[model samples]
Structure formats: C-alpha cells, structure tokens
Target: MKDDDTRIKFDSEEELIDYYCSKPHPKAFTPSIVIVMLLCSLVGGIIGMELIVKFGLSTNSSIIGALIAVIVGMLPMKFARKFRNIHTQNLVETAISCATFGAGNVLMVCVSIIWVFNKPEMCTGILIGGVIAFVVDITMMYWLFDTPLMGADEAWPIGIATAETILAAAEMGKKAKLLIGGIAGGIIGTWLGLPMDIIGVCGLGNIFALTAFCIGLIMNGYWPTWFGYSLGDYYVPQGVMVGAGMVGLIQAIILIVRKYKGRSKTETPKEELKTADSTFIEPEESELTVEQENELLGEKDEKTGHIYTRTTKQMTQTFVRGIILYIIGAVIMALIGGIAAEMSEGMLVVWVIYAMAAALISEILVGISAMHSGYFPAMATVIIFLVFGIFIGFPPHALAFLAGYTACTGPAFADMGYDLKAGWILRGRGRHVKFELEGRRQQYYAELFGAAVAVVLVFIFYRSYFLAGRIPPVASVYKATIDAGVNGTVLRQILLFAIVGAVLQLISGLKRQIGILFAAGLLITNPIAGVAGLIFLTFRYFIEKKFGDEGRKNLNVVSAGLIAGAALFSFCTNTFKLVSTNSKKG
Candidate 1:
C-alpha cells in the first residue's frame, strides 16, 4: 500500500485540521448538544414573550431587550471558553447566537402585532396562544421524531424534528399544531444544529442544514404550499401588475443579450490575447495547507499557532468601505425621516417612495464600489426604519414595512450567500453545493408560516376582544395621536431634503450635496434647532476628508460612536417612560 503520508500532499497535520474544520460537516452535533440548544430556545422564547407582554412592542423596548439578551447570553460563554473543547465551544457559541436570533424574531412578531393593534390586553391571549402552540409542537417532536433520529446523520435530524411536530399536531386534532410544529422545528434545527455545522465548516454548510430542516417541516404540513410564489397576492396591485411584468421582461432581455454575447465570443476562436475586463478574468485558486484540507474533509482544526489563520487585509478593507457607505446611507435615511414627519396626507405613498428610492440608491452605491456590498445596504435599511419610526411615526400596518424589508434584505441575503461561497472555496468545500438556494427556500417557507399563524391569531383576538366589546384603549390612543399629528412638518422637510439630495447626486457628481441636503432639510423644519445637525455634518465631512489616514479612521469611529450613543439614549429614555407609566398605573 502507498504510504499514508505520501498519499496526501499536505504541508502539516495542523494544516489538514484547519482545512477540514473550515468545510461543512454532514453530522456536526451529537444528540446531547441538540437537546440542550432546543431547551435554550424554549427558554429564550418564554423570556421573549414575557418581555413583549410587559413592555409593549415599541421600537425602544425591542432594541433594549434584544441588546440585553445578546449581552447576557454571550458573556457567560467567554468565561466558559476555557473549559470547552473546540467542538463544544462551537456548539455553545452557535447555540447562543441561534437563541438570540430566535428570541429577537419572536419578540419582534409579538411587539409588532401589539403596535399594529395598539392593545396591551390583547397581548395576554395572543401570548398564551403562541406559547401553547410552541410548547405542544416541541413536546410532540421530541417524543416521536427526536427519539428515533437520536443518532441519525445528514438530514435525518431535521426530517425527524419536522415529522414528529406534524404527527403530534395530527394526533391532537388541531390545525394550529401544524404551525406550532413547524415553528418549533425551524427554531431548533436552524438555531442549534445548523449553526454548528455551518460555522464548523465555512458557514455555507448552514444553508444546507437549514434547507433540509425547512423542507422536512414543509413536508409535514408545517409550511404553506404557496410560500414565496404568492408574490402577486401580497405585493402586486392589479393595476401595476402589467408594469411589473414589463420590468421583468426588460431584465430578461438584458440577460439574453449578455448570454448571446458570451456565446458569440466562445464560438469565435480568438487567437489574440484577451485583456482582463469585467467580462473576463483569470480563474483564482486558493492553496490550503494540510490542516485546512483535513477540516474540509470533516476533521477539526485545533487552535494551535500554526493551524489558525488571520483574516486577510483585503477583507478588512472591504469591511471598512462597507461601513462608510452604510453611515452615509443612514444619514440620508435620517433626513428622509425628518421630511416624512412633515407630510400631512398621503403619507403612505410618500413613505413607499422614500423606501424604494433609499433601496435603489444604497444598492447602486454598493454596486459601484467594489469594496462595499450588501452588508452596508442592510444596515442602511435598518437605519431607515429606525429614523422613520422615531422621527415621523411607525407605519400602522406591518405590510408596508415588510415590503421594504423584503426588498432590502433580498440583496443583503445574496451578498451573504456569496460571502459564504467564498469561504467554502477557500476551505475546499464542494463547488457544486447549492446551499444558498436552500436557504432562500427555507426563509420563504418560514415567512409564510409566520404570516399565516399571525393572521389567524390576529383575527381570533380581534373578534374575541373588539367585536365582543372588550376592546382596550390602545387602538383609540394610537388613533388620537395620529389625529393630533406627531411632528408632520419634520417628516415633510426630511422627504424634501432627500429628493433634493438625490437630484443633486444625479446631476452634480458631488457626494457632499447629501450633507447639504440634510442640513437644509433640518434647517427648514426647525431653523434654530437644525444648526446642530448642520454643524455635525460639516464637521464630519471636513475632518474626515482633509485629514490623513489616521484622521479618517478617527472620524469614522467618532461618527459610529455618535450613532450608537444616540440609539442607546433613545432606547433608555423610552424604557424609562414605559416604566414610569406602569408605576403610575400600579
């Protein structure tokens, strides 16, 4: 037999481990870890529901609670790190992260509904319904599917989790059981095992696990059949459907043109040297050491000095550039918020336009700048939500916000997919693997399930409370605020400024015009108070642009600090108000 050492061309054992550790593993978790993470998720869900009920679903409450949860959950892991082996550490960290995401998602849904309905008492019934559903689903899955698939590899855990949840619901003779099972399976599968597998390999593997889990749930009647294909019912208005179709046709034409050009080039055998351009580039390959190879092949990369690799300078540069674009995009959004506050009527139209424009501008900027990508765009979208909600007012219906969020997240998700692919390539994972497609499918199904569940609960609660004359004052209070007008002039000015800024950006080729637009918009809204905004914008531009590399870095950090500080202040102030109100009532 050929020598084992000579058979594999690895630089070192450490290299083999490192490479293997970076690739996706089909079976990354033991049964115990899965159980623990699922339990953590249940706990997180309970805590999240309690907070949502107590605090109401205001922006401040959501942010503060999420922040606290993340900090508390992560801090313990740092100390426990010393005792953990590599796999254990990954499992623990991944579990925490998954739990955090799940908790936030649950909290947001509850709070969003309350905000929409403006009812505090309604929270009790909905909370009870949601929790009962979740618990029942989890219990059923654990008893049936989880036990049988305790040591199953590949997609079996997901299949079992999903199957058991569905089967349990069927046995109970409850349609809601299907929903509960799906949600429970999704949360446990993605948050616990999926993350470990993805992180253990190159993050790309998570997509597969997530996909399998979602598919399993769907097969068990946990997901809606229409799913993402229901775009027409949700998004497209009858009148505008034709226009949307035209846009798709145009895009298809462009795609065909590109494809035809490529085919022509390939058909024409070029004897001449082809210059590197956007259309063509040399194939780049990454050379991995023995540890990296081993990791890709489903081994572990011990944190030896020789095994671990530092993040590349190019990646650092990309991150920095992305951050800069994100900040600029945020400032623009803030200005829009101020303007939207000024609009008296047709606010929805104005809001929709602003959202669409912001999405387009952010995408264009990120696309033009090679260093930046979807990360900055995602940040901008979230900032836009914050600015609009606080300065103008949160949207009455979740649909509008959901539409904008979907638009923004689409590109961001694509960017994340590409980033994972890069990691997979670097770690020597299979090239043919289509994990992102699976992730997308999973997200679609999850959203469908969530929406369906929410709709049913909302209807039930509305009938039970409002139609039956047990209505609370929450809706009335919200309506009264809307009638009184919550700083409409500010929103109008912000919108005007964004329009002016966009026009200037298109015509003048001057990026500073954005700052000018913001300053002028704020000034128009409140002349005396707006000076501070002007000063800040001016100082930021001059200090950052004129200074050396160190100066630019300092300014960037300072700007980020300012945004973070303001957000923190707003959150604390809002929480204090809620507490004071509760105290007074008590």
Candidate 2:
C-alpha cells in the first residue's frame, strides 16, 4: 500500500537486486541480534539435545523452533526498519543454526541404538564419531554449501518459511501483533507445563508429551467403551491420538464455517465473483527463470533449473579444497576418536574415512534431493550407511557411529545449504572476516561458530544425562536393531515405505514434510495426527482464500507458539531430570 511496501513485494530477482542494492547496509550482525542469538543458541542446544535423548524427535515443524528462538532471542532489529533485511537474515541464520544446531540428533540416535555395546553407559567411542561428524560437517558447510545453495531450486520450505516470518516480523502490521501474541502464548503455555512437584505447582499434562497423560485419561475412566465396544484393553494411544485429531478437526471446521458464513456480509457481488476467479498459488520455486536469473548472476546456467553454479575448474577446486580440509580435520578426529575409543584399534581412522566417503556420496544425492525436491531420505541414507558398516564388519560401537554419523554430517551440509540459499536470496552483504578468510561472509563464521557451540553443549548434555542414568531406550532399541541389521528389525518394511515417499516427492514435487507424513502414515500404528493436520490445512485453504497473508501469518503464529511451547516444556523437564538425579547421586 505504501512506497516501501511496493518495493518489498519482490516479483523477481531483479526487484530483489533493486531493493537490496538501493540500500547501503552499514552494520552486519547487529548487537541486539547477537545477544538474543546467544540466549537462543543456549536454549536451542539444551532443548535439541534433550529431545533426541528423551523423545527421539526434534521440532518437526522447524518454523516453530525458529519463531520461538526469534521471540526469545529478542530480534529487536527485525522490527526496526533501519536495520537491513540482511542483518535480520543473519539473525535468523544464527537462530536456526544455534537452535537445532548440533549433530546431536545423530549422536543421540547412534548412541541410543547401540547403548547395548556400552551397557551401563554411552560409548565414549561414539563421542569421537560425533567429533568426526561435527568437524566434517562444519568443513563442508563452510567450504562447499555456498556453491550448492547458489545452484539449487528446491523450495527449502522451512528456510523460506522462516525468511517469510522474518519479513513479517519487520512489518508494522497485524502480522507483528500475531507474532507477539504467539510468543506470549508460547511462554504462558510453557509456564503452565512447569513441574508442580519439582518447580512448585505449574506442572501439568503437556500436549506434546502426551504419552502418560493420554494413558492416564483412558485408565482413569475417561472412556471405558467406544461405540458399544470395550476400550479397556484397546490401548490408550488409540483414544489419545483420536482425541488429538478431533480437537484439530473441531477447530478447523469452526474456522471454515465462520469464514464462509461471514463472507456474504463483506463481499459485493462483483468482488465475490472476482475472488472466485481462478487463482494459482505459486509453486514454492524460483520466481525467476534460469535465463532471467542469469542476467542478475552474470553467469548463465548451462544446466536447466540450476543457478550460480561454478565452472568445471571451480567445481574441481572446491572438491579438492573440501577434501584437503576434510583430511586435516579427519586427523584431528582420529586422535579424538582414538581417545574416545581408549584404544588404537584403527577403527577410528577407518570410520572417519568411511564417513567421508559416504558423506560425499550422500552430499550429492541428498543435496540434490533437498535442492530440487526439499526431500532427502535421511533415514534411508543412514540405512544404506549402516548396511555398508555391516559389510565392513564394524563392531557395535563403530557400526552405530558410522550409520548415525554419516546421516548427521551429510544432511547438515544440506541444512546449511538451505540456510545459505535463503541468505543468498535475501542478499547478505558478504563482509570479509579475516585476512585468511578475506572474502568470507560474517554469517558463514556465525554458522561455523553456531556449529561449534551446538556440538559442545549437546555433547555435554549427552554425557551429563548418561551420567545421571538416563538411558534413552529408543537409542538402545536402535542399537539392538543395528546388531541384527535386517535380521533384527522391521526396518526393511519401513525403508520400503520411505523409498516410496522419496519417489512420491520426486514425481509429485510435493514438499518433504508431506513425504514425511506419508511415510509416518504408512509405518505408524497411529495416524490420527496426520489426518488432523490434513483436516486443518483443508480448512486453512478457505481461510487463506478469505484473508490471504494476514490470515496465514496469524495461523502460523498461534500454531508455532503452541508447538514451541510443548518443546520448551520437554527440554526443561529433561534438563530437570538430569539436574535432580545428579544432585541426588552427589
């Protein structure tokens, strides 16, 4: 509506260039963002580590965590127009990097699976594997992801969503108010879930941690029967999952009814028809064609759908440099791995090399998948890596490490690439960091630093929780499964579904999140939640039709808050568990 609004509504990359180039952005990473990032990083690490340890799931909808971090991080710059979008972009970058920020997911999954090998404790050997992953992942992120991100056309859906959220945060509109409300709601929700016994009275049933509450509700006479059938032995998850879905469905149906019911009052006859005219929601793909974007990049993509790619010579150099850095990093890792192993069995060197080789192959496969489809079969890749490890005749410790570490490190490169992809689109002023890294962007350092912080904090928590006698049974289950490989688990069937999921993504060009839901629907005994999501989104389409961006932003804010609140509670509960148990032991 305003001159600034006109500029901000970028229709193409040229518009982006005009808007960004018009501004002489003075500051890089503003101080307010930095301070908030530190807090976010700490919280993210704690929560992220705790999730894998306790629940084996991180924030599936990453936007929730990103929004939570932004709210908690006090992203004051995003609200102030004086600060460039690039600065805000950097803030989002740090927030996201710090938030899930660790290879912790891999470590938790790996260690938990093979806890049998270590028996009473987690293998220190795997810590070395984590170290190897952390270093190699970082190296790839710093040296290689810039190129990958530059070329890919995948939606990078979460990254784009975060960027859009950041954009919304900057707007002095209802969007900002909704985001503020979401933050407040999330905080309140988290407070309500605080421990009554331990933290004194706020402890209550949580929406996310529904297992105990779900069963308790059933066992405590909430429902003894359903439709003339006895439910006493029907399993509580069935009811809980059903209740969760119904709750979602009720909200959606109400919203849809309200929208169409009210629409008649606001719409003129002509306007109603105009609104009903055919509308195509843009695919979450490039706004510019490859040819058009080339005009902006000063480099044409000889290959279709890829942009800003390196020449063959440049690609070769990047490869050589990446490998050289990897080899050096591997040496440091081998030493740490040997230490973690507490013996020179030579598996450390072998596993590191194995990880590198697997990661390289995965980087191409998964990276391409993420770049073009926003769907990388991370679990499938890990399965393959584990199979490779099985062939290598790795001991339980090394086997678990190889599979999990490969899974973690390769996808990390993809994650960084997506973050950078968003950054590239937003156009960060690539500030020189050091003489040795003269051309590097400050955000790259920020990402690298985040990587280091996340690894340290998560590993510390991982060790601390283990010391406090938290043996994540899920990981132990994985370990048991790994021991037998195909003979041990139902993984072959799951992998089949996962591969089908990948193919669906490839063929339909659906987002990875959808594929994930599809996979879960196939494998899990419970799929009521997915059904609820589908119902909610179906309702959401009508809401968007009625209210557009304002409606969506509002929905995202409330949803993000609800989801993030649950995550906060989970983290705090886990952290308290470790602290209290450790104190008792002391």
Q: Which candidate is the best by lDDT?
A: 2
For candidate 2, lDDT tens digit of each residue in 1-586? 2255223444433344345534543232557556545665666666666666655555422444345544543434434443335444444455455346363455555555445566434455555555566556655555544332234234443344344445444453555565455545555655674211111101111111222222222332323333554332332222222222223323323533543465444223322322433211121235445432222221222343233222223444555665565555444544544433643557666766776666555554455444433334455455556654665666665565555556556556656665655454344222111111211245565555566667667556665677765655556545654776543233333343344444433432222223322321222322233333334445556776899887764665454444334444555566677577658969
Report every candidate's CA lDDT: 0.30, 0.45
lDDT of residue 395 for candidate 1: 54
**lDDT agreement of model 1 with the native:** 0.30
Worst 10 residues of 1 by lDDT: 145-154
For model 1, residues 1-586, the per-residue Cα lDDT tens digits are: 1223212233432344243344433222345444443444344333332233344322212122223323333345543322122222223322332232223323234223444454444444333333332222222221111011110111221112222222222123332244343344333433342321111111111222222222222322311354544211221111121222223223423533443455434222111212211211122126444433322221111221111111122223333443344333323432332333434447655554444444433332322111111011222233333344445454543222322222232222222222222222222222212221222223223222322333343444433333444332323333333334335564554454454334433332221222222211221222222333334434545665688675643433233223223333444455566568658969
Q: Report model 2's TM-score to 2 decimal places.
A: 0.57
Stretches off by above 4 angstroms in model 2 are: 1-33, 60-86, 92-96, 107-116, 119-125, 139-152, 173-306, 309-353, 363-380, 428-440, 472-474, 485-586
